[model samples]
Target: MTLVRVSRGVRMHREAEPDLAAHVRPLTRISGSCAASHDTAARLWNFPEPERRPFDRRIHISRPSGGARMQRPGVVGHRSRLLPDEVAYVDGLCVTTRTRTWLDLAEALEIDDLVVIADYLLRIPRPEFEGRAEPYATREELLAMLRRHPGKRGLLKAREALALARLGADSPPETRLRLAMLSAGLPEPEVNKPIRNDDGDTLHAPDLSLPEYRIAIEYEGESHGNADQIVRDIEREERARAADWDEVRISKRHMANGARRAVEKIAVALRARGWRQEDAA
Candidate 1:
């Protein structure tokens, strides 16, 4: 008969020798702040995967005096205080709240990147907002701050951030398609702007519209595959034509190439409409 001594509190393989010290080494390497969350009871007992990023590898733990005495190599420590509810114990490690996680990420990432992360975090299933005990008064408060900032850079950043923080499923393909246009250095078009007939009846709202150019771009997604959607799209196109607007329809396949071709097509259409690229630029 073969006998094996399985280590308690850590998984052991019968076929392999267990290195208890090696297993504990990783735990020791974690910064005290991240260890709070990553190594908390919820993660250890429940065995939940930690949502750690490359940036989190350098977490710095602060002392009660709101200062960091020592930091691990490659880790940066900030002297800050966390509220009680904002803290969670996991696997004997301290984890920051989701709100704090987002705030930190927002400060670190570019507006576009921050928007992507914010969108991802907001879409998380049943997210808990921790604004009551944090620097920001509320999520809306933060959004308002972004909106209040001057210039297109601030407005666009705020818009993207707010869009990311919106509660719902992933954004529609049209929204993503429009964002690609902005990222491609094209002038931002009004989103879902309406085109009305002379009779003032609402005709159609194109996915993106540049009134100055009298041009509209429509994103045809998988939903347009349905017979009803196709009919509606055609009707919309005809109405746009009647309204003297040059309309271009782009499918998901076309948008996958990152809007270079779409921008060219738009430029051509604008040229035909008596507008110059330099003028638009």
Candidate 2:
């Protein structure tokens, strides 16, 4: 029977299916106090990160401050002051709390990227579909965690991200789009507000909206390319038109170069709907 080496001193059957859990479990078992953290923990929690190089296979583990950092091949270890409450268990493996993981990432991620994670945590989960009723974390919980870990390496950046983070952002692209508009001096757009028809029934909920200006903006991810999704999108746009709302559709390409092109599209829509450049001033 051929065995594939997964980590140092850890092996599995060559024909066995491998997964993140299979890799992480052995490393965490190396020490009772050690737990998966950083990017490893983020992955376990299903957090979204910005596009980067190929996925890293190394395991990131952390323990309380007194212990020496775990050093071994295929492992990147960190030592930090991990309070008991700052750690949690996910899928039977110990990991950092969602908010602490966010704080830890502040050192490595850009402010906007951090905000992307923050927005994700703050988004209200639909219990029926997501199997949870509440958000992953609350803004107040994040603030309290920050207060506990002042003077840390990325405290400043984390605080800045928290200030910019807003609820209702459903995806990284939506958060990035909102940030780009703000940086470009465009008025902040409302996130995911429902547009209702004449009978006061919800017509469509835009990813970002300026309801006062009667304009709705959507970020079209690659999934929109699906034939069925395209048909649904057309129907949605038709409903918006019947409701007297102008819609701006954005795609990944438009988000390039600091979302300059995306903002231009939205700005034009706003201008035609009675918004002015000076109004934002």
Predictions in order: lDDT: 0.52, 0.87
lDDT string for model 2 (1-281, tens) is: 79988777778889988688777877887778988888888887788865542224578899889899988887888998899998887677888989999898876777887898999999998788889899999999999989998799899999999999999988889999999999988889999989887789898789999878888899999899999999999999999999888989999999888889999999888878888888878
Instruction: Please estimate how well model 1 matches the true structure, expressed as its whole-model Cα lDDT.
Output: 0.52
Model 1 residue 51 distance off true place after TM-score fit, in angstroms: 18
Quote the positional error of residue 149 for candidate 1 in Å.
16
RMSD of 2: 2.2
Point to the candidate with the largest lDDT.
2
Candidate 1 on 6-110: residue-level lDDT in tens? 322234345665342333334433445432221221222222122222234333333223545435444344443454555545443455444444443443445
lDDT of 2 at 178: 99
